[model samples]
Target: MIGGFFDRYCGDWSPDEQALFEALLEEQDVDIMAWAIGTQPVPERFAGDMMIKLQRLDYLPIDR
Candidate 1:
């Protein structure tokens, strides 16, 4: 549910923008990782779909 909101805003965003959002929102870990892809620091369990979604939507950052 919350991830939906995050991904929703990630649409049409640049890689840098996406990274910013994720970094800013990655304060806590999520339990619903069924659709998740990958984590920045790499969480114990991450949703692969989430990573692809962010990358596809250009929500992920390039280098920072």
Candidate 2:
């Protein structure tokens, strides 16, 4: 489900956001949940803006 959202919106994402999307796909659900909720440290490569993009997903406009 998350992967679907990423693919759907990612055409407009920055390169770093794209990278983080792929990285998230490679992770387990628990880890992804922790990262999304700020309970664990996001990997250095996926920190900062990448995490910010994901955390702000609720604000993303959906066509449907």
Candidate 3:
């Protein structure tokens, strides 16, 4: 999931966004997945445009 997100958006991200993503990488995978799936509340620091985009889950290839 993270890899797909990076592939789809990393190239277009600004340096700040890239840094934000890198910081996000330091978080637990389960936490990240929860945020992406909306199963848990996103912490204030991680709640913003990037998280919003992740929640969309459009980069994932699974049929819906």
Candidate 4:
């Protein structure tokens, strides 16, 4: 999937990564939730904005 410093939690990085996300969000140019859970494919059963952010960071989960 994504090539980066991903860990186990990377799969479920939604609002969970608050600290890191907040910092990134402050950057403004970066995605707030560059990682997320429950999001896959184009249209997500979860939410689009979160998915979009994750996809942008290539941090969303792959269908296992």
| Pairwise TM-score winner, candidates 1 and 4 | 1
TM-score of every candidate: 0.32, 0.64, 0.92, 0.24
Q: What lDDT does each candidate get?
A: 0.50, 0.73, 0.94, 0.42
Query: What's the lDDT for candidate 1?
Result: 0.50
Please list the residue runs of candidate 2 whose C-alpha ends up more than 4 Å from where it truly belongs after superposition. Answer: 4-8, 14-16, 59-64
- For TM-score, candidate 1 versus 3, the one ahead is 3
Which tens-of-lDDT digit does each residue in 4-32 have in candidate 4? 42443356666655455444445423222
What are the clash counts of all predictions, listed in order? 6, 0, 0, 0
Give candidate 4's root-mean-square deviation (CA, Å).
11.7
What tens digits encode model 3's per-residue C-alpha lDDT throughout 1-64? 9999999999899999999999999999999999999999999989999999999989989975
Clashing pairs in 3: none
Select the stronger candidate by TM-score from 2 and 3.
3
Please write out the lDDT profile of model 2 over residues 33-60, one tens digit for every residue: 7877788988887678657757666745
Judged by lDDT relative to the true structure, which candidate is superior, 2 or 3?
3
What lDDT does model 4 reach?
Answer: 0.42
Against the true structure, what is every candidate's RMSD? 10.4, 3.7, 1.2, 11.7
| Residue-pair clashes, model 2 | 0
